[model samples]
Target: MTTTKERALDAAICLAGSQGIRAMTHARVDAAAGLPKGSTSNHFRTRDALLAGVIARIAEGERADLAPAARGPIHSIDEFVDVFTAVVTTLTGPHADRTRARYALFLELSSDPELQAPLRAQRAAFAELARILLAGLGAKHPDAAVEAFMAFGDGLILHRLTVDPGAPVRRSVAIAVRGCLEA
Candidate 1:
C-alpha cells in the first residue's frame, strides 16, 4: 500500500493536472486521496513543501520510464531520435496529465528562485542524459546539441499537448535530432 504522503502527492499531481494548480489545496488533496482532513497538511506542512514533493514524485516516475533507454549507449542519430520520439509520445499520451502538471508548475513557480530549483534540476537531469547520448554519438558540439534538442523537445511536447495532439512526434524528433547532430 502507498503511504499517505505518496497518496497525497499523487492526488496533488492529479488535481494540479486536471484542475489548475491554484485549485490544489490541503483539504482538496486530502479529499482526492481519500484521506482525512489533516492528512495532507500533516505530511506537507506548506504549499511549497507539497509542490516540492509532487515534483519529486513526477521525477521518480519519469526516471523509471526512461531507465531502459538511459542504461545503454545510444549508437546512432536514428536510435536517439527513436528514444526521444518514444518520450514525446508517452509524455503527450498516457503521461499527459503529469506532463501538464509539470509544465503548469514551470510556468507558475518559475519566478521564485528558491522554489524553482527542483523544476530546473529535473530538466537538467534530462539534459544531462541527452548530453551523454550526444557525446556517445560523436556529436561535434554535444552541449549545443543537447540545448537545441531539449528546446525543440520542450516546444514539441507543449505543442502536441495543447495545440495538436496528432502532431508527428517522430518526424519532429528526427528533425531536431538531425539538426542537433549537424550543428
Candidate 2:
C-alpha cells in the first residue's frame, strides 16, 4: 500500500521522466496519481511546495538507488564505480527520454535560486560522498580525482547527446573512468 505522498512522488518521477518537470502541475499530478484534484492540496498545500517535495523525493530515491556510500572502506570506491555504472546505464537507457526531460528542467533550475539551492545541495553532498570514497582509495589528490570523475561523467553525458555518431556511451564512460583512475 502506498501513501498519498509516496504515490504522488512516483507519479511525479514518471511524469518528470516523460514530460518536462515544468509541465507537471498539481492538477496534472492528481490526474497522474488517479486522485481527485484536492489530493495535491491535501498532501503538499501549494504547487511550488509540491514540486519541492517531488524533487526531494527524487533525490532520496537516487541516494538509495546509488548506494555508493554503503560499502566498506577500500572496496567502497570500487562499489562506487559499480553503483555509478548501474545508475548511468538506467538513466541513459530505457529512461533516456525522461532523463533528457529532467535535465532540461535542471538546466532551467540552474538560474532559479529557489530551485538551485536544493539542486546544488544534492550535487555538493554527492561530490562530498564521492570525495570521501576516493580518499580511502589512496588517491593522492582525492578531491581532484572526484572532481575529474564528476566532470568526466557530465562531459560524457553531454557528449552522448551530441557528436561522435559512431561511439557508445558505456565505451565513453569506460574511457573516462579508466583515464581518471589510472591518471
Q: What is the lDDT of candidate 1?
A: 0.88
Task: Residues 75-140, candidate 2: write the lDDT tens digits.
Answer: 634455566666666656655544564566577677777965776777788787767766665556
Q: Mind giving the per-residue lDDT tens digits that candidate 1 earns over 1-183?
A: 999899999999989988979978999999999999999999999998998899899889888768766889988888888887888899888888889999998899978877778778878989999999988887789999998888898999899889999989988788887788789
Model 2: colliding residue pairs: 17-98
* Global lDDT scores for all candidate models: 0.88, 0.67
Q: Candidate 1 — which residues are off by over 4 angstroms?
A: none
At residue 53, give the lDDT of candidate 1: 92
Looking at model 2, which ten-residue stretch has the lowest summed lDDT? Answer: 158-167
Give the runs in model 2 whose Cα sits over 4 Å from its true position: 76-80, 93-102, 157-171
Candidate 1 accuracy as TM-score: 0.93
lDDT of 2 at 167: 39
Clashes of 2: 1
